[model samples]
Target: MNVTSGQEWVRGQFPRLDWLPDETLFSLCSRQHLVMGNLDPATTSTAVLGLSEKFIKHDIPCGIAALEQNGFHYWGSAESILLHHTIFSVFVPFQNKIKIEDAIITIKGDRIDSLKYRLGLVSSGFGAEHPLKACPYCMREDVDAHGIAYWHLTHQYPGVLICPRHQAWLMVSTKSRRWSGRFEWSLPTKDCLIQQASSQKLWLRPAFLNLANNVIDLAVIGRVMSLESCTVAATYRKAVLQGGRSASLLDRIEPLRRFHLFESLPEDEKSTESFMNQLIRTPRRSI
Candidate 1:
């Protein structure tokens, strides 16, 4: 029940604001909060969080419920954008190797929803610290077209450091809170840009740029959830073979030279080895 002006205590039902295309659930929820008039983001979020089931960690459960009520399709918002899109795409080598459908089931299954276990919660390698990224061009374009800037579905994914359309490096906003605590949904603005990026090395490689775009394609347009892990691994092997960057050959290459041969990219341009150290473990099934 949203306490804002006694706006009907409809359990499991949420009010729908005019949601922006590719808007994050966080951003949409934030907008909903603001519409209640004069409510600060924190207070508004707390109000919405009150509607969710106890086990739901992030605001996603209620956020999805609200969006679902509003007639937005379920898969793109919840599974593709808000959930494990980052790890499934860029962070994992050979995206084709992932059993995306099974992975989706595992994440959204009753086991997780029931609060029975926290199996994939900490994607330490992929989810460590991707700064809140936005392309300035995309923001300006949104303001021009939609009249309000909102987080893009593509921009929110962790490994995506470039805007697929703009081809410019996405600027990292210096937000008030870190990733875990950042429930304050914000749209990109000129004010949010880090002035240091112009002088600093924040750019991404073309290969990575293409890969990020491909990941988004897989996420939004393609039906990749049906892929099997063996198929995924096989695809990876093919790429490696075609690349001719066998492990034995890679050993003789220099550090910078070896990078191209390896399918893995550092989580960010400035990522340290220790930060990207964790392995993508194989899924365990119940007996």
Candidate 2:
């Protein structure tokens, strides 16, 4: 029960927390905390999540039943929240059906271990740093339209450095504690922008722009269908063949030249041979 104002707790009678379009579950929970005026995070967590000590994860949060019990059921069912409010859509294109089902079952509960591994995120060589990112234009517009700035699930996707709508580089938060701290529920503001990231402009190269658009499209499409590894590899092969290239010719291309194909990738990734191989190889399962 929430200790704020010495109020008695009632099941499913919690304060109204309407869902914002494309807003993350973390952001929704954070806004609830703000509305309740709780000085301690555990107060809000116990009321909203039915847990007193659970950490709020930005990417893949668990305990959907708890959230529903606390009056967020109108936001949607457990599965609905997982697909609409979390980063699960981004992984759907790569994951198999069985894996996706297991993810749904696990996420509906309170367990967190192995979820990343099952989704292939642990092996993807990306998402090593779960930085809280926000597009400045999005923030300003959201404030104007909705009266508050909230986190968008799309902005937090791995390798998504630019805002698909604004074509502006997303600003990463400089304060780790803002998102990582047990009690902090900081929102986007110009003051939160990382110093170096604030000074930089979007990389407007054609390849960079194309990759950003394709990634956003895939994430949106993944909500309905799974693009299995075999289908993806087949598409690549078809594209190569249509371009008057063969397997042998592709194999003969020098490694540096292959690396050049992904020149827009982060420098750290280009320097890692295993990461490069993973990107180009047709994987047996999820990549």
Candidate 3:
């Protein structure tokens, strides 16, 4: 965690540091490392955020304020960085205002562990286990256009198996959290693509494709609107209760078969069934 000194070369408006559209802050620092010929990830981290690369995060990055202050103002303010470059926008519609504000403050102040608990992600049953993913087509195109492959924020999430623009499957990175050097700078490249992951073959399933589309849609909508949970729940309940059938019948309908989806279902897959039942049973509340 050595702090780099005498970095006057990166002091102001570094035109060489090209911040690509939808590029993760981690990718920006990684690109800067290549552009500046930094000897190691730690040196790049020190130059970009004045912090340690040990704390470098991809999904929801911390030290945003530091990045903004460290001659990267052209990328915009911390708030803009959170909205545009990080995965913060995807959680906007699902989380409350106070939690959102706390996340922003924590991200700016370098509380990486606390940010998860603050956002209710500790019990959300998502995130941590998912690998960083990238669409191969996007990577190839990025290399052709920008001369380097970078990570995209959209493809790096739980349940986001498909690429929105290309409608192609996303490949999980082998050098993800499961790897020993997870915190080290990594970009989307063929050498790091994990082809043996279970979900690698899930692109053939219609249900998964549907889920991916919905996830992408929510991500896009969440950027501009804060959807109410009650409203969303009520709408889902209404759809389930359509045709004058009790919501209990939802369990009897084989979702995979009905939609001609997944090859196998987990024996203990009660979460969705229970959620829909509860949603239908609960009285609608004013939003």
Candidate 4:
């Protein structure tokens, strides 16, 4: 493939790639130099000299020499050139992870001839924020305080009430002393509250008398649980008593939606909903 053909295919897959500036491509290619170690330091340094010879052989030295001096490397093999050009083509922002099988290159006499390589969408992990720890639910290293608190589902003892926390969820395990679950309080919903409490810093306040009271409650309760779920249920009960919206069967849809990926379906059409919907709507206790 040529540069034109590669660009056309990339633009077709992702419309956003069409607007990237030339400097972005250069930056991507520079970063990928470490990945493709085929060209050693000696070969890299001699690239300009090689290009100069080619220019002289073609009887075009004046402009070609200036271009060669401006960091252009001449590859004797088409494969090497195609490898470099492929890196350049896929350097679009927010797109990474090009598959090697998708690339196109020409070869002649055990050397790479002129070729164009198609670039794929870049990997999403390229510019993502790194977390200090892993999330228990997703088991991903991308967990943050805000992400854990706001995005995760909270389950109660009776399995009737489910909610997402606007603040941190305290996981109390029957066999554990210290809390062994993740916490996120930096999400948009609790950001203002956390800011006001700690002057914009991550803070934890030790409960003195309340800690004793919570221990007493847990001892009498006989079940390990999430504090946030209890709080949400209590709040919901009060709202319902005051003429709020009654919890409907539709509220179960979210959990059902979550399990959809496990549903058994035709091989070609297997998806999240097919498996989960069946499980959620059926009563396992009766079975």
Candidate 5:
């Protein structure tokens, strides 16, 4: 359809479409300039129409910089089946705001891609209202990394769940803003869980150990059991063990007071030690 016809349809769907043209529409339409409403008595109509003009000049550099500052990234664009029809699309967060004059110049051959106004519904309360599921490591909710929400328990994993290729320990903190933390693991296997837990006490710094204790409390109170229950503890232990003298010094200076959380320390200690022992005895580093 023509620009005016399309704008009329859009206005019918959204009453607010009457406002000044926005970047979102520009990206979607891929038209340089759009004429809204008719100026002449012969073409007068209450409905707004978008008309495509030959030269819709815009400043490029300023526009693109503005968009980048607000966390929008260039996705891609496509040409319509009809001749001279193109559509550009970008991924921008709904919560962030943008203005019209923001322009950035980019040269591709002779064509220029200009930044316009921002679009998208407000996502302020979107993920906030929902309960976050604990990741396997830091026992916190998974969050978007570089735009997409990650699913793995720890940030140590490159993208999604723990890397299937590496034996890296990933951790995420509920109290911290960092997406992921990484630690080394010699031979990551099922039995290593207990070993890592036991060794954690010997290696982790007091501050991180305290952090681990807090996570344990949260897990118990929340009553949401999963690999996080074991993995969180394992991560803390692995961090301490691999952290070497720096971690050991912290542990020595700040000994943890006994908490009545677990009923039997001896039994717990033995079980964890035995598990670790088996892991150390095994000879395999298969990812």
Candidate 6:
């Protein structure tokens, strides 16, 4: 941050720093914002809200000052950073969960934006209020080695209830990305995790952790996988039938519903079995 006479290079004030492993755009933005001033995270968020308006391009950095300067490297590539690390990145993967689509690779910018109407993700309804989580042991290790701590993208995924490394339970801070249009710049604290870590033995409960890991794996694959097919549901039905549970998936819907994450839905949507059956009957509606 050099000065020419009394003039300062605004860009150099907050130059893009080397990114951390598995960092997300919001996390990176928050980190950069901290260098600017001691203002509230809400103000920082408002300042960077324009970052979301950007679309990927071959050149011109990421359209955001700090990110564009880095040439969009590290943690994730330029393409994956924009398409998967940002908040908007959730749309494509979530929609793909309905059905795999090869077209996801070539999805038009406008088409992606239009999903705003079909899916109400912007209002913090879909996995937004879900707390920004951190692993306590990881934080301690990072702070001990690097003298700082920050959020990891892996722990932020909704279904990732446990830390893959250390096999410790991840914990959320007091703040969350609420629908109030204000984001909080909360770094991991000592109390960020539960006092007792029940997930420390995840390896022993192979079945439970394996299922969660599978979902996380799909989350990673969904990023690069084409959006042209749907196999998860069919495979689930096959497994049920093979186990002599029931030929019709409906027969086991009650058991499946117990594990499904429907807490984010409205009370009316609490009926997972009914919704699953509806999607089955009118499969085209899913598209």
Give the least accurate 10-residue stretch of model 5, judged by summed lDDT. 78-87
Ranking by TM-score: 3, 2, 6, 1, 5, 4
lDDT of 6 by residue, 1-287 (tens): 34653233543455555567776565666576677574665444434432332332111113333333333334444465555554334344446543223323223222233333444454544443356678888888878876678777777665565678877666766545344343455567766444223433422344334544765676665566533324545654555457643234343332223332423332333354464543334236345
lDDT of 4 by residue, 126-232 (tens): 21111111113321211352122221111111111111222232232221112323221121122221111122122222221232234334423322222243344
TM-score of each: 0.60, 0.78, 0.81, 0.13, 0.17, 0.62
- Candidate 1, residues 1-287, lDDT tens digits: the string is 34953444442254556557766555665566655553455555445433333323322233433334334444355555434322334322323333444444544432334211222323323343345567888888888997777666577565466688887767766662254354454556778666324533533357557656766765553434334445554665565567544343333222323232222534332342222122222323320
Candidate 3, pairs of clashing residues: none
Residue pairs with colliding backbones in model 6 are: 100-227, 100-228, 100-229, 101-226, 101-227, 101-228, 102-227, 102-228
Q: Is candidate 4 or candidate 6 better by lDDT?
A: 6
Query: All candidates' lDDT scores?
Result: 0.48, 0.68, 0.69, 0.25, 0.26, 0.49
lDDT of 3 at 150: 91
Off by over 4 Å in 6: 1-8, 46-78, 83-117, 120-128, 177-182, 191-208, 226-233, 246-282
Give the Cα error of residue 108 in candidate 5, in Å. 25
Error of 4 at 69 (Å): 9.0
Estimate the overall C-alpha local distance difference test score of candidate 1.
Answer: 0.48
The per-residue C-alpha lDDT of model 1 at residue 200 equals: 30
Where is model 4 more than 4 Å wrong at Cα? 1-118, 122-287
Q: State the local distance difference test value for candidate 2.
A: 0.68
lDDT string for model 2 (14-130, tens) is: 568788778988888889888888888778777777764455566777777787656667878887888788877877887788988998888877777678876767665555346
Across 32-96, the per-residue lDDT of candidate 5 in tens digits comes to: 11233334422211111111122122111112222222222232221110101111111111112
What's the CA RMSD for each of the models?
7.6, 5.5, 4.9, 23.8, 22.4, 7.4
Residue 142 displacement in candidate 3 (angstroms): 1.7
TM-score of 6: 0.62
- Candidate 1 Cα outliers beyond 4 Å, as residue runs: 1-6, 9-16, 46-63, 66-124, 176-183, 195-205, 221-226, 247-287
| Clashes within 3 Å, all models in order | 3, 0, 0, 16, 21, 8
